[model samples]
Target chain A: MDLQLIDQFAKNIIFEAGRRIRTAFTYDLVVETKSNANDLVTNIDRETELFLIEKIKSFDSTHKIIGEEGMGEKVDSLEGVVWIIDPIDGTMNFVKQHRHFMISIGIFVDGIGKLGYIFDVMREDLFYAIEGVGAWYNDSPLRKLQPVKIEEAVIGINASWVAPNRHIHHEKVIELVRKVRGTRSYGSAAMEIAFVVSGKLDAYVSMRLSPWDIGGGTIIAKEVGAIATNLRGEGFDFFHQDTFIIANPSIHQELLEKYIVQYD
Target chain B: MDLQLIDQFAKNIIFEAGRRIRTAFTYDLVVETKSNANDLVTNIDRETELFLIEKIKSFDSTHKIIGEEGMGEKVDSLEGVVWIIDPIDGTMNFVKQHRHFMISIGIFVDGIGKLGYIFDVMREDLFYAIEGVGAWYNDSPLRKLQPVKIEEAVIGINASWVAPNRHIHHEKVIELVRKVRGTRSYGSAAMEIAFVVSGKLDAYVSMRLSPWDIGGGTIIAKEVGAIATNLRGEGFDFFHQDTFIIANPSIHQELLEKYIVQYD
Candidate 1:
C-alpha cells in the first residue's frame, strides 16, 4: 500500500469534515441524550459521521468502515483494510463548548494501524502519523518525546477517576494527582492523546474509552515515542472498550505500577 | 475616574503585552522555581510585568499597582486608582505548555472594580469588562449567564481540592465532583474565570489563589451575572490569598453550603 497516498487522502477527508463541523457551529445545534444524561449527541455528530463514511466509501468501496455514530459497517473482525472513525470524539464538548473536540480516523490493515489523523476541528490543527514514516503536527515534524519525572509531569485525567467511583480506587488516583505538576481534563480523549504527542501533556489516563476514541491518536502518540496501554500495563485491544493509559515512556510503567488500582 | 478611557488604555497595553508574549514563545524560556518546585516563574513573566507597569505608570504615575512579579507598590489600602496585574496568570503553563497562560489586569477605583481584562496570550482572545457597562469577548458583548443545575454544570476545579489537603475536606469535594456533569482544570485561574463568564464552564473553585490570579476575571464574571466569593460564601478580599469559588449564581450558594468545609 502507498502510505503517503493514504495519508493525503485521509487528511483531505478530515479537513472537509472539519469545515462542515465549523459551519454547523454557527447555527443553534439540536442535542439529545445518548446512554446517559451526560452522554450527549448532536445533529452535527451524525451529519459529520455520514459525511466521513460517504467520502471513505467513495474513495474505496472495498474498505471496511467502523464509526461511532453507527453510520458505517458493523464488522466483528479487524480483517482487510479497515477505517475506524470518530466523527466528533468529544461530542459533549462539541455540544457544550463548540471547541476542544476533534475528528479522528485510523486506517488499519489486518489490525495493524497504518495511517492516522486527528484534526482539532475548531483550532484547525491537523495531527497525522504514517507508520514507519513519522508523525507531523500540521506541517512540522514532531520530535521524540523526552522523559519527565512524575513530579514534573503534567497529566491529563478526568476528575471522575479521583471521585468515589466503581472503576478504580479513588485514593490512588488522587495520590497521583497530587504528585504530578498539574492535571488537566479537556473532555476529549482524542485531544488528550494529541496533547501527549505534542508534549503539552505528559500523560493521559482514563478508566473506559471506546476504540474509536483513541484509535487515531494512539498512532500519532506512538510515533513520538510515547506508550499506550491498558491500566494493567498490558497491550491495548483496538477492538474492545477498555481502560487506557497513554503516557511518556519514562513514566507510563511507574504510573501503572504505583498509582493505578482497578476495582475489580 | 473615567472608566471608559482607562478601559481603552488597559486594552491597548494588554494587546501590546500579548504580542510581546507571542514573540517570546519562539525563544527558549528561562524558568525559575518560586516557593516550590511546581510553582514556576519565567523571565517573560517578569518582563511582561515590567512592560505593563511602565505603560500604567506612563498613563497615570499616581495609580497604585500590585503585581504578581513584585514590580508594583505595596499599598495598604485600595484607595484611589489601583491596577492589579498578573503578567502571566498561569506561569507554570507558560513555562511548560506555552499556550494556556493568560495576561490578567483588573482596574479598581477606591476598592471598587472599575474595569477588567483577561487576554488569552496564545489564542489572542481578550475578555474585558467595564463597570456598569458590559463585558465583551473581543468585540462581541457577552450575554447574561444562564443558570445551570449542579447535575448539568461543568465546573473548573483542580484535583488538589479533592485530595488529602489542608484547606478543605476532601470527601465533600469528591462528592461534589461526582455530582457535577463534568469538571475541567485548565491550570490558569484567570482562564477558568473567563470560562465561567463565557458560559463554557458553569463554575470555578480554587482552594488558594492570590488576588492577582482572580482579580481581573472576577470583574468580567460578575459583569455577566456570575458570582465570585470565597469558599465560605463571603465576599473576597482582593489584598490576600484565599480559597475561592466563582460560579453561576444558581450553583454558587449550593456548592459553598454543601461542599466546602474549611479545615479550621
Candidate 2:
C-alpha cells in the first residue's frame, strides 16, 4: 500500500469534512443524548462520518471501517486493513462551544496503526503521522518530545478524575495534580493528545475512551516519542473502551505507578 | 476623559505588546518561581509590563498603574484613573506551551472599570469593553450573554481547586463539577475570563486571584451582562486578592447557593 498516497487522500477528505463542519455552524444543529446526558450526538456528527466513510469507500473499497457514529462497517476484532474514524471527537465541545472539536481518523493494517490524521476543525490545523515515519503539524515536522519530570510537567487531566468519582481514586489523582507544575483540560481528548505531540501538554489522562477517540492520536503520539496506553500501561486493544493516558516517554511510567493506583 | 480615545490608545499599545510577545518566542525565556512552585513569572512578563507602563506614562503619567510584575505604581487605593496590568497572564503557559497566554489590561476611574483589554498574544485576538458602550472582539461586537442553567453550563476552572488544596473545599468543588455539563481548565485566569466573554465558557471560577488577573476580564464580563464577584457573592475590591467567580445571570445564584456552600 502506498502510504503517502493514502495520506494525501485522507488529508483531502478530512479538510473537505472540516469545510463542511465550518459551514454547518450557520445552521442549527440537531442534537440527541447518547449513553448519558453529557454524551451527545449531533446531526453533523453522523453526517460527517457518513461523508468520510463514503469518500474512503470510493478511494478503496477493500478497507474495513469502524466509525463512532455506527454508520460504518463493524468487526469484533482489528483484523484486515481498517479505518477507525471519529466524525467529531468532543461532540460536547462542538455542541456547547462550537470550537475545539476535531475529526479523528486512523488507518490500521492488521491491528497496527499505520496512518493517523487529527484535524482541528475550527483552527484549520491538521496533525498526522505515518507508521515508521515522523509526524507533521500541518506542513512542518513535529518536534520530538523531551522527557519532563512529573514535578515540572504540565499535564492535561479532566477535573472529574480528581474529584470524587467512580472511575478512579480521587486521592491519587489529586496527588498527581499537586505534583504536576500545571494542569489543563481542553475537553477534547484528540486535542489533548495532539497537544502532547505539539508540546503544549506534557501528558493527558482520561478514565475511559473508545477506539475512535484514541486511534488517530496514539499514532501521532508514537511518532513524537511519546507513549499512549491504558492506565494499566497496556497498549490499546482498538476494539473496546478502556482507560486512557498518553504522556511523554519520561513521565508515563512514573504517572501510572504513582497516580493511577485504582480505577474502574 | 474621552473613553473612545482611551480605547484606541489601549488597543494600539496592546497590539504592539502582542507583536513583541510573538517575537519573544524566538528567544529563550528566563523564568522564575513566584509565591510558590507553580506560581511563575517570566522575563517577558516583566518586560511587557514595563513596556506598557512606559507607553501609559508617556500617554498620561498621572494614571496609576497596578501591575503584576511590580514594575508599575504601588498604590493601595483604587482612586483616580488607574490601569491594572498582567503583562503576561498565564506565564507558565507562555514559558511551557509558548501559546495560550495573554496580555491583560483594565483601565478604571475611581474603581469603576471604564475600559478593558485582553490580547491573546499568539492568536492575535483582542477583546475589550468600554463601560456602558459595550464590548468588541477585535472589531466585531460581542453578543450579549444569555443565561445558562448550571447543569447545562460549561465552566472553566483549575483542577487544583477541585483537588485537596488549601484554597477551597475540594468536595464542594467536586460536587459542582459533577453537576455541570463540562469543566475546562486553560491554566490562565485571564484567558478563562475572555472565554466567558466569548461564550465558549458560560462561567469561570478561581479560588484566589489578584487584582491584575481579574481586572480586564471583569470589565468585559460586565459589559456582556455577566457578573464578576467573589465566591461570597461580594463585589471585588480592586486593591486586594480574593476568590473569583464570573457567571452569566441565569446560573450564578444556583452555583453559589447549591454547590459553593463553603469555601475559603
Candidate 3:
C-alpha cells in the first residue's frame, strides 16, 4: 500500500468536507437533539459524513467505513482497510458556538492503525500522521512534546471532572486542578488533543470519548511522543467509549496514578 | 469628554501594546508568581502596563491609571478620567499556551464608564465600546444579545467555581454546569466577557474578579444589551474584588435566582 499516496488522497477529501461545512454556516442550520441535550447533530454533520464516506468508497469500494453519524458501512470490528470518521466531532459547539469544532478521520488496516487526520475546520488548521513517519501541523513539523513540571503544566480538561460526577473522584480531580499551572476547557476533544500535540496543552483528560472522537487525535499524538491511554494506562480500544488521558510522556503516569481514580 | 476620540486613541495604543507583546514572544519571558501559583506576572505584562500608562498619561496626565502591575499613579477612587488597565489578562496563557491572553482597558470619568477595550493580541480581534454609542468587533458592529434558554445557553466560566473552593457554593455551580448547553473555561475573564458580548457565550460567571479583570468587559457587555452584576444582582464595585455574573438580559435574573447560591 502506498501510504504517501493515501495520505494525499484523504487530505483532499478532508479539505473538501470542510468546505461543505463552512458553506452550511451561511444558511440556517437544521439542528436536532441527539441522545441528550448536550449531544446535538446539525444538518452539516450528517452531510459531511456522507460526503466523506462517498469519497472513500469511490477511491476504494472494498474499504470499510465507520462514522459518527452511521451514514455508511456498519463497522463492527476493524477489518481490512477501515476508515473511522467523525465528520463533526464537536457537534454541540458547532450548533452553539459556531467554532472550535473539527473533522477527524482515522484509517486502519486489519486492526492496526495506519494513518490519521484532524482538521480544525474554522481555524483551517490540519494535523495528520502516518505510522513510523511523523506528524505535521499544517506546513510545519510538530516537535516531540517536552517534559513539563506537573506544578507548571497547563491542562485541557472537562469542567465536569472537577464537579461531583459518577466518572472519577471529583476530589482527586480538584486537587489536580489546584496543583497545575492552570486549567482550560475548550469543549472539543479533538481540538484539545491537537493542542496537546502542538504543546499548547501539556495534558488532556476526558472521562468518556468515542472511537470516532479520539481515533484520529491519538494517532497524531503517538507521532509527537505523547501518550494517549485509558485510566489503567492501557492502550485505546477502538470500538467503544472509555476514559482517556493523553499527556506529555513525562506526566502521563503521574496523572493516572495520582489523580485519575476509578471505583474498583 | 470626546468619547469617540478617546476610543480611537485607546484602540491604537492597545494595538501597539499587542505588537510589543508579540515581540517579547521571540525572546525569553521573565515570569513571576503573584498572590499564588495560579496567579502569574511576566516582564511583558509589566512593560505593556507601563507602555499603556505612559501613552495615556502623555495624552492627558490628569488621567488616573490603575494597572494590574501598578506601573502608574495610585488610583484610590474612580475620579477624573480613570483608566483601569490589565495590560496582559490571562498571563498564564500568555506564558504557557501563547494564546487566549488579551489586553483589557476600561476608562471612566466621575465613576461612569465612558469607554472600554479588550484586545485578543494573537488573534488581533479588538473589541471596544463607547458609552451611549456602541460596541465594535474590529470593523463590524456588535449586535445586542438575544435571550437564550438556560438549557441551551453556553456559559464562559472558571473551572474552580465547580470545584471545592472558597468563593461560592461549589455544588450549586456544578448544577449550573449540567443545566447549561455547555460550559467553557477560557482562563481569561476579559476574553470571556468579550465572548458574552459577542454572543459566542450566553453568559459569563466569575467569583473574586478584581476591578481591572472585569472593568473593560462590563462596559462592552452593557453596550451589547447584556447585564454584568454580582451574584446578588448588584452593580460591580470598581474598588474591590467580588463575585460577578455577566449575561444576556433575558437570563441574568434566572441564573442568579435558580443556580448561584451564596452561603450566608
Candidate 4:
C-alpha cells in the first residue's frame, strides 16, 4: 500500500471531520448521557464520526471501521484494512470546555497501523504519521523520540489510577508517580498518546482504553520508535477494550515488567 | 476607576504578551530549572512576564505590581491599586507541551479584584473580565454560571490530590473524586481557575497556590459571581501562599465545608 496516499487521505478526512465538529461546537451542543451518566456524547461526536465513516467509505468501500460512538461498521478483528476512529475523543471537554479535544483517525492493515492522524480542532494542529516516515506536527516532521529516565521523565496518566481503583494497584502507581519528574493528565487519551509520540511526554499508561482510544496515537508512536503495548508488555488487541502503556522503546519493557500490575 | 479602561488595558497587554509567548513556542525552547529541578521555567515565562510588567507600568504608573518570576515590584498589601501577574501561569505545560498555558493578570484596588484576564496564547483565546461588566471569551460576554450538583459536575483538581497529600485530606479528596461526574487536571492553575470562571469546570482545588497563581482567575471568577477562597472557605491572603478552592456559587460552600481539609 502507498503510505503517503494513506497519510494524505487520513489527514484530509480527519481535518474535514474536525471542521464539522468545529461548526457543531459553535451552538449549544445537544449532549446526552452515554454508557453511564458521567460519560457524555454530544450530537457532534456522532455526527463527525458518521461524516468521516461516509467519507472514508466513499474512498474505499472495502475498508472496515471501529468507532468510539458505535456509529461505524462493527469489525470482529483487526484483519484486512481497518480504520479506527474517535471522532471527538474528549466528549466531556467538547461539551463543556469546547476545547482540548480532537478528531483521531488511524488506518491499519492486518493488525498493523499504517497511518495515524490526530487533529486538535480548536487549536488547528494536525499530528499525523505514515509508518517509517516519522511523525509530523502541522507540516513539520517530528524528531525521533529520545530516551529519558523515569525519574527525569514527564509522564501522563489519568487520576483514576492514582486513586483507589480496582483496575490496578494504586500504591505501585503512586510510587511511579512520585518517581517521575512530573505528571500531567489532559483527559484525552489520543492527545496524551500523541504527546508521547511527539516526545512531549516520556510515557503514558492508562487502564480501560478502547481500541479507538489509542489507535491513531499508537501508530504515530510506533513510527517515532515508541512502544504501545498492554500493561503485561504483550501485544494489544486492537479489536477489543484493553489496558495500555505507551512509552519510549527504551523504557517500555522495563515499565511493564517491573511496575504494571497484571492480576490486581 | 474606569473599569472599562482597566479591562481594555489589561486585555491588550495580555494579548501582546501572549503573542510573544506564542511566537517563542514555534521553536524548541530552552527549558530551565527553577525553584527545584522538577519545577520548570523557560525563557518564554520570564520574557512574557517582563513584557507585561513593562506595559502595565506604562499603562498605570500608580499601580503596585506583584508578579510571578519576580519581574514586578514587591507588593505587600492589596492597598491602593495593585496588579498581580503570572505571565505564563502554566510554566511546566509551556516548557514541556508548548500549550495549555496562559497569561494571567488581575487588577486589584483596596484589596478587591477589579479586572482580570487569562489568555491561552497558543489558541489565541482571551478570557477577560471587568468588576461588574461580566466575563468574556474573546468578544462574547460569558453567561452567569449555572448551578451544578457535585455528582453531576466535572471537577478540575491536581491529580496529586488522589494520592497521599498533606494540605488536603487525601481520603476526603479521593471520596469527592469518585462522587463527581468526572475529574480533570490540566496542570495549569490559572487555566484551571479560568475554567471554573467560565463554567467549563464546576470547581477547582489546589493544595498550594501562590497569589499570582489564582489572582487573575479569582477576579474573573468573581465577575461571573463564582466564589473564590482558600480550601477552608475563609479569607485568602492574596499576597501570601495558601491552598485554594474556587467553584460556582452553588457548590463552593459545600465543597469547602465538607471535602476540604484545612491545615491550621
Model 1: runs farther than 4 Å from truth?
none
Candidate 2 lDDT (Cα, 0 to 1): 0.88
The value of fnat for model 2 is 0.88
Ranking by DockQ, best first? 2, 1, 3, 4
The segments of candidate 4 whose C-alpha lies over 4 angstroms from its true place after superposition are: B26-28
Cα misplacement distance, residue A167 of candidate 4 (Å): 1.9
lDDT of 4 by residue, A1-264 (tens): 676776677777777777777776557778789789868888888888888889889988989999888987668988889999888888778877888898888888998878888888888898888887678998789888887887788788777778888877788777777777777777788888888888888888888888888888888887788899888777777767788999988878777766557665
lDDT of 1: 0.88
- Determine which window of 10 residues in candidate 3 chain B has minimal summed lDDT: B255-264
Q: Which candidate, 1 or 4, has the higher lDDT?
A: 1
Best by TM-score: 1
Model 3 agreement with the true structure over B152-262: per-residue lDDT tens digits: 898887777788777678888888888887889888999999889999899988878899998898888879999999888899988888889999898899888877767
> How well does candidate 2 score on lDDT at residue A20?
98
Estimate, for each residue in A153-194, the C-alpha lDDT of model 3 and write its tens digit.
989887778887888888898899888878888888998998
- Tens digits of per-residue lDDT for model 2 on A154-221? 99998888887777787888888888888999999999998998888999988879999988999998
Q: What is the TM-score of chain B in candidate 1?
A: 0.97
> CA lDDT of B159 in candidate 4?
65
